[model samples]
Target: MCSHYEAVNKPERLKQAFQVAMPEGAKADVWPGYTGLFIRRPKEPPQEEGVAPWREAMVGSFGLIPHWAKDTTVCKRTYNARSETVATKPSYRDAWRLGRRCIIPAEAFYEPDWRSGRAVPTRIARSDGQPMGIAGIWTGWRAPDGTIIRSMSMLTVNADEHPLMRNFHRQEDEKRMVVILEETDYDSWLDERNAEPRTLLKQFDPARLTASV
Candidate 1:
């Protein structure tokens, strides 16, 4: 599960790569509680036909805050949601059911390698050096003061059989990796009508990934 990552902070890069206008001041490094950028369909869709599906970038807390949560502390454990149980898990089910799908653009993500008897922080990025478009879900939570807080969580799938992803985490723990979306599926994955976005939650191509300690 991804709890730490290097966010794509350059506005021009975001605009060019994801075609969304990301606001300035996005943090370069993001952790569970850090505020980061996410790309999703605009709250109001364009009425004109023939126009491409529009996307907008917004800032949100990295950890998902359920509507029922009293505070933001829950973000510590909600950064990554298991795809298999997301539809039923209390923290993620609502977002999934409501189709709050999003894309998290990251320069790279960190994972732990324990094969050497001690944890080694490994940086994982695309072999081509482009930013990664990670599959995620987002939601809005109202605070006691009536302030709306947007938060998101990355989706992960079982990676026990993946050639590259299976090397991360502990030797005994069940292996898991985040769902990296293909460039071609970005618009489709955000379609609210796509009731089965869960089908896109699969391990990314190992050949397209590069890992360094």
Candidate 2:
């Protein structure tokens, strides 16, 4: 699963890609606890309804801690929710059922290849070096004082047999990668579409993708 990634790193890049500004002070490199941006429909009424209509950009906790969780500690293990079981997983089910979809932007994400019995850090990015619009889910958590703390989690798919992805992770574990959405398909992914979003879970073309250790 993706535990770390680098964002586009420039305000102009974000505006060009998503028509949204990078939040002030948001870190370019993201980890479990790092603050980063996510795109989702605003909850307020008169909601924008097009493919990307009414989307709002917010800086939130990267690892999801369900809105109703008793504490934030649960976020440590909920960073990446498996697409196949996301709708049924305890930590992610509610958000899935309620349409808490989002996009996590990243320039590159890191994984480890254990082909040589050691953790080797590898970076995955588009051959063009543009930012990847990663599919994700988000929700708002309430603090003790009634303030809301938003958080999000990346959606991942099994990649055990993938030509590029299979090289990562320990040999004994299942290989998985975050679902990266094409910019043109952003609206479909954000809205309720075709009843099965899994249909959009295509693995990136390793040919157009570059990976380096």
- lDDT, candidate 2, 1-213, per-residue tens: 999999766877876788665567568899887777898876653332322345667788888878778977777788899999999988999988988899988999999989898999999998997889999998888988888888899999888878899999998898898898988778778885437777877677777788998
Candidate 1 regions with alpha-carbon error over 4 angstroms: 45-53
Estimate TM-scores for all models. Answer: 0.95, 0.91
> Distance from true position, residue 90, model 2, in Å?
1.1
**TM-score quality measure for candidate 1:** 0.95
The models' CA-based lDDT, in order, is 0.90, 0.83
What's model 1's lDDT at 66?
94
RMSD of 1: 2.5
Best by TM-score: 1
- Per residue, candidate 1 scores C-alpha lDDT tens digits across 1-213 of 898999998877887788877666568899998999888999776444333348878899999999999899999999999999998999999999999999999999999999899989999999999999999999999988999989999999999999988998999899999999999999989989997787788999999999998
Report, for all candidates in order, the number of backbone clashes: 0, 1
Off by over 4 Å in 2: 44-53
